[model samples]
Target: MHFVIERNRFVHDVQNVAKAVSSRTTIPILTGMKLVATNEGVTLTGSDSDISIETFIPVEEGDLQLVDIKQEGSIVLQARFFAEIVKKLPGEQIEISVLDQLSATIRSGASVFTLNGLDPEEYPRLPQLEEDLMFKLPQDMLKNIIRQTVFAVSTQETRPVLTGVNLEIENGELICTATDSRRLAMRTSTVERNDQELSFKNVVIPGKSLTELSRILEENDELIEIVVTENQILFKLGHTMFFSRLLDGKYPVTSSMIPTQSKTSFSVQTKSLLQTLERALLLSDGKNNVVTLKTLPDQQIEITSVSPEIGKVTEDLTTSEQEGEEMRISFNGKIVIDALKVIDSEKVNIMFTGAMSAFVLRPTDHKHYLHLFSPVRTY
Candidate 1:
């Protein structure tokens, strides 16, 4: 295989694919990236079983020439070295050629590097996905959805299903939900489809894959195509393809966990509440990280956090509105702070069903996203 390519474009594509390479992969072959150069363009693939990312650079895109093919072939390059070498190449153009004996030569400007390349035939093939069940949504929208919910996925593998975000599509709406038992984050957005009756349910995508996919996608209004089968999901964005394995086992039915009524409710500036929670967290320790919220009859909300060894921290803010009753609730300060970070509204409304029940938090301006946090019991 031989090809001379635009250095910058090659570097960008390499970096993008490298995100899928896992350093701890048990399969040695999976650690390297597979590159195929054809008459059409060069395609680079990286995978670590759970997730695979493939990106293609056409020989010519519109009026731009991205790659010049000297010979059509395929080879696998050491991802660690190839990724690093591509970036530090000292020129605008890069030339790579592989010999029949399997040694590869890379040259750019005054720098020359020879690395042993592997036969591409040994690399695992990407999963074949049928396009029968597919939908489209804006890239930025999907990125936002992942950002808003992936954070809440369980970090512990005890409940593997909770380590992924559950994605469900119905009635033209796509919803993504993530929870770690103590807190949950849910975001919904509209999907575009030619078929009005298209719908799906219970597609759980690993949080790690969602986080990597979000990082791979740039902020854009361009639509992304999503294809789903029984156990895998594919995301197509421009010349890039992202594939993730769906987690096994059913995701817990989260709808029932959201409270239907509240004994105490209040609305306050989102930033103010977030800041107060952050300040209170300064005194929090361990898993408890507890913060107490006391609502005064005067409609002022007082927040406090205390540690046996450290000093207590407190803040008070006047609520814009209050209803139901004056109450006090304790919650894991860190979880609530993380939940607040995803809210994109100036004002946030929080509802408490009771001192011990799960409470709901959401932006007052948008009804599409909701966050729920289980309060910590503080006597």
Candidate 2:
């Protein structure tokens, strides 16, 4: 196998594919990246069993040439070393050639290095799913959905299903939900499906996978194609393809858990509330990170936090609007700050059923996304 590729383009594709390669992979060959050169273009792939990413660089894009193929073949190279070498090479182009006995030579500018290559045949094959169930979403919108929910997924592995984000599609609407039992985040969006009759439920994707995918996705209006099956999900972004294995257990039913009505409701400036909670948390117990919110007269609310070793903090914030019964609620201030940071609107609406029940937070102008937080019992 021999080929010469533009240095910058090759570096970009390598870094993207390297996101899937893990050094702790049980399979020895899985740590290496597979590169295949064909008549059309050059393909790079990396995987660690649970997730796989493949990207292609065409021989030429319009008038600019990307890759020149001397011989059409394939090779697997150590991902860690190869990526570093390519990035630091002082050259406009890199030339790679595989020699006898699975040895490869890399040359650029005045630098030359030889790396022992693994046989590409030993690499695991990526799943191939029929495009029977496929839909499209704007790249920027998909990134927003991931950012809004993936953080709320449970880190504990005890309940494997809760460590993933649940995706459900029905009647042209797609809902994504994630929860750690203590808090939950949900987002809803309309999808363009290839089949109008297609619908699915309980398709839980690992939170880690979505986090990585978000990093690679550029914020733009380009549409990304999504294909879902029983056990795997594929995200097609132009010439790149990302694949992830679905969780095996059933996701807990969460619709009944969200409160339909609130006993106390108020709208407040999102930034002001976030900053107040951050300052209050500084004086609270680090372990609990609790902050107390008490409704006052004249549409004002009091925020306070106290610690035995430290002192106390109190501040009054005037709400834009307040209604229902006056109440006091204590919750983890860190969780509220996280939810507030993701909200895009200037003001946020917070609704509480009671002091002991879960409260909901959402943007004042949007009904498609919301965050629910379970209150803490403070003495």
Candidate 3:
């Protein structure tokens, strides 16, 4: 294989594909990246069994030439070394040629390096998914959904299903929910489906895979095509394709956990509440990280935290509106802070069924997202 390509574009594609390459992969050849040059363009692929990413660079775009193919061929190069070398190569263009016995030569301005290549035939083939069940979503909106819920996924391996975000689609609406038993985050959005009759449920995606997919997607209004199957999901962004394997177990039913009514409800400035909790968390017990919120007369609330070995913090915050029965609730300060950081509203509405029951937090301006937190029991 021989090709001369523009350095910057090549570097960008390499870094995107390298996100799937893992050094600890059980398959030896999976650590290397596969590069194939064809008549249309050059394709780069990387995978670590569970996830795979493939990107293509066309030969030319309008007036600018991206790649000049001298001969069409394929080879696999060590991902770690090849990625580092391509970034530091000092030149506007790079020329690569594969020699006999799977040896390759890389050349740039005044620099030449030889790397031993692996046979591309040994690399595992990516799944060829049919586009029967496909939908479209804006790139920026998809990124927001991942950010709003992926953090709440359980890190413990006790319940494997809770380590992923559950996705359900019906009647043109898509809902994403993630929880770690103590807290839950959910986001809902409308998607455009190719088939109006298409609907799916119980599709759970691993939190780690969604995080990596979000990192590669650019924030823009461009529509991304999503294809889902029984065991794999695919995200198509321009010339790049990302694939992830779905979790095997059934996700627990969470709808019944959300309360329809609240005994205590109040609206407060989101920033003020977030900042108060952050300050209180500094003096709270390290293990529990608990902070207490107690409603007072005249639409005011008190925030306090105390530690046996340290000092205590107390602050008074006036709510915009308060109603129902007055109550006091204690919860993990860190979890609330995480939810507040993702909210895009100036005012947040919170509701509680009782002092010990799970409370709900949501933006006053929209009903698209909701966060639920279970109170922490404190003596």
Candidate 4:
């Protein structure tokens, strides 16, 4: 392969795909990135089984000449070295050419270097999903959905299904749920599809994939086309393509866990309550990191936490509105922080169900997202 490209453009494209590379990959060759030179442009691919990301840089991007191709070929370069070399190149232009079938040369400005590369044929092929079952979501909405739910996925591999976020499509609405038994995060968003469009259910996406997708997105409002199949899901954002392998087994029926009515629901300032808990968590660190909530009459609430060895901490938090009976609840400080970080509202509704049951937290502005936390007993 031979091509002359701009240093910055090359660096940006390489870095984007490199996000999929894993340092602990079982396959040695999978650690490298595949570089394919075609008549239209240069394509770069990186994968680590669970997720694969591909980026394309066309020769002519509108008026700019991004790549000039002299020969058409493909090769796999060490991702660690390739990324560093492209990013730190001294000049505006870069010339890359493959020699002796397994060696590659990259030159820019006053620097020239040659490195050993592997045959692209050794790389695994990306799985393809048909466009039959595809839907579109606003980039901002997709990013929000992933952020709101991915945090709740279990980090431990005790249950395979718990490490994935469950996705269900019905009636032009997409519902995403993530849980680890201790806490649950669910986010729903409307799609831009008509009744004629196809719908799917029980799609499981690994939490790691969703986290990488969130990072890859540049916080845009552009509509993204999502294509799904039995084994794989693809997210097409203009010229780039993101692919993730679906997890096996049925996701738990999370709808049944949500309560239609609550014993107590009150609106509390999101920032104020978050700040109060942040302070209380310091004292509760050694005491199971538990925070006690006492909801009183007249829109007043007391937040307290105590530890036998450490000093106690208490804070009075103000609320916007209160409903139902006054009740007290206790929650894990870590779980509360996880849910509160994603609640993007000025105020939030906290529901106290029972001493042994999970409590629901909802955003006051949007009814699309719900955070449930299983309280820890510290009495």
Candidate 5:
């Protein structure tokens, strides 16, 4: 295989798929990136069993000429050294050629290096789903869903289902939820689904996969195509495609966990309360980083946090308008921060029945997302 590619263009595509490559793997070939140069363009693929990312660089895009292929073949080059060498090479273009024994020579400017590559056949084949259960949404929405909910997933491996976000698509509504028993983040979006396709349920996607997907997605003029199969999920973003393995077990039913009524509610400024807690967090211990919120009349909340030896801090946060039963609730400040970041509005409504039950918080203007945090068991 032989090809000439712009140095910067090659480096960009390499970094896109490098996120999928595994550093610690029993299969040595999985550590390298698979490069396929055909008549169409140059394709780079990286995989590590759970996720695979493929990006193609066309010969010409708009006014930029990316790659020119002389021979049609594929080769796998060591990802660790190849990425570094190409990035530091001083040149406007890079020339790459592979020999019969899978050895590659890369030349640019006055520097040239020979690196051993593996046969592309050794790389694992990516999953191809024939099902048409697909949906279309702006790249930003998909990226937001992953960032908001994936952080709440369980880090423990024992309950594998909790480590993934449960997704269900039905009647044009796509709901994503994640929980680790302590708190939960739920985002419901009205996504455009295929009119002739059937709806599905219990599609648990690993939180780790969504985290990587968020990195690949940017806030741009691009729409991402989502296709789900029985055991794999595919994301098509222009000339790039991403695949992730689905979880095998059933995700817990999270809807029943949300309460039907709240005994007390407070609609306050998200930034004011968030800033109050940020200062209070300084005195909180790593084990029990608890913050107390006391709702008062006239749209005010007294926020306080205390530690055994560190000290204590308190603040009175004012809001636009507050009307609900007054209550005092203690919760993990970290979970509150996570929930606040997801809300995209100026004011967030906080609702709770008591200190022992689940509490609900959501943005006032944006009601599509609800962030619920279970109150910490405080003495």
Candidate 6:
């Protein structure tokens, strides 16, 4: 197999695919990247069981030439070394030739390196799913949904379901929810489903996978195709494809967890509240990351935090409007700040169910986004 590719374009594709290659993978061959050169283009793929990413560089995109293939073949090369070498190649083009015995020789200008390549036949095949169940949404919208919920996913692996974000589609609306038992984040958006009767339940995706996928995706208005299967989800972004395995267990029913009534409801400036929480957290220790919110009768709220080693912080901010009963509640300062960051509106509505129940935070303009935080017991 022999091919010549533009150095910069190849480097970009390699970097994107490398996100799926894990250095700690138990399967040695999975650590390398599979490269297939055909008449159309060259395809690069990487997989680490949980996630797989494939990107193709066409021979010519419109008027620009990207790759030229002399022989049609496939080979797997060491991901880490090959990526580094491609980035530092001397010229504008890279020439790679695979000889007998699975040996690869790469040349660019005066630089030459020989790498032992593996037969691509040994690599695991990616799942091929029927396109019957598919949804289309702008790439930026999908990324925003991930950002609003991924932070609340459980980090502990004891409950595998909580470590992933639950995704469900019904009535042409897509809902995404994430929870760690202490805090929950939920976001809903309308989607254009290809089939009116197409719906899915218990489609839980790992938070880590979504986080990495978001990082690799560019913020653009381009449409992205999402294909869902029983065990895998595929994301098609132009010439790149991303695949993630769905978590096996049933996600907890989170709708019932939302409070139906609240004793106190008020609207406050989001920036002010977030700034107050950030300053208050400075005095909180790692284990005791608690912050207190006291509602004063003067249409103001007091935020405070105390630490034995550090000091105490107290800040007061006037609320936009306060109603119902006045109350005081304690919660994780870090979690509150995380929830606040995703809110896009200037004012946020805070609903509290007395001092002992979980409180809800949501944007005043956008009612579809909700964040709930469980109160922390402070003696």
What would the TM-scores of all predictions be? 0.98, 0.98, 0.98, 0.96, 0.96, 0.97
Flag clash pairs in model 2.
none
Q: When superposed on Cα atoms, how far off is each prediction in RMSD? A: 1.0, 1.0, 1.0, 1.4, 1.5, 1.2
Off by over 4 Å in 6: none
Kindly list the per-residue Cα lDDT of model 2 for residues 1-379, writing each as its tens digit. Answer: 8899999999998999999999998899999999999978899999988899999999999999999999888999999998888989999999998886388899999999999999999888899998988999999999999999999999999999999999999999999999999999999999999899979999999999999899899989799999999899999999999999999999999999999998999999999999999999888667889999999999999999989789999999999779999899999999889889998989999999999999999899879999999999997
Clashes of each: 0, 0, 0, 0, 0, 0
Q: What is the lDDT of candidate 5?
A: 0.87
Candidate 2 deviant stretches above 4 angstroms: none
Local accuracy of candidate 6 as per-residue lDDT tens digits, 1-379: 8999999989999998998999899999998999999999999999999999999999999999999899988899999888888888899999998987388999999999999988899999999988878999899999999999999999999999999999999999999999999999999999987689878889999998999899887789899999999899999999999999999998999999899797998899999999989999887777768999999877898998988776888999999679888798999989889999999999999999978899999899977889998999887
lDDT on C-alpha atoms for all candidate structures: 0.91, 0.94, 0.94, 0.87, 0.87, 0.92
Question: What does the lDDT come to for candidate 1?
Answer: 0.91
Candidate 5 per-residue lDDT, tens place, 1-379, comes to 8999988878987888988888887799999999999977899999888999999999889998888899888899988788888889899999988987488999999999999999888788888788588888899989888888999999999999899999987778889999999999999888876664557889999999989888889987478888989899999999999999999898888899888797887678788778788888988777778999888777777988989787889888886556667788889998888788777889888888887899988889976788888887777
Residue-by-residue lDDT tens digits, candidate 1, 1-379 = 8999998989999999999999899998899999999999999999999999999999998899999999999889889889999999999999998887367899999999999888789999999998888999999988899989999999999999999999898999998999999999989898998778889888999999999999888888999999999999999999999999999999999989999888989999988988988888877666688889999877798998889788988889999779998888888988888978888889999999999889999899979999999988776
As for lDDT, the candidate ahead, 2 or 5, is 2
| Candidate 5 Cα misplacement greater than 4 A, ranges | 62-64
- Compared with the true structure, the alpha-carbon lDDT of candidate 6 equals 0.92
* Candidate 1 residue-wise lDDT at 73: 92
**Ranking by lDDT, best first?**
3, 2, 6, 1, 4, 5
Q: How well is each residue in 231-304 modelled by candidate 4, as lDDT tens digits?
A: 89999998789999999988989888987777877888888888888899886655478888987667888988
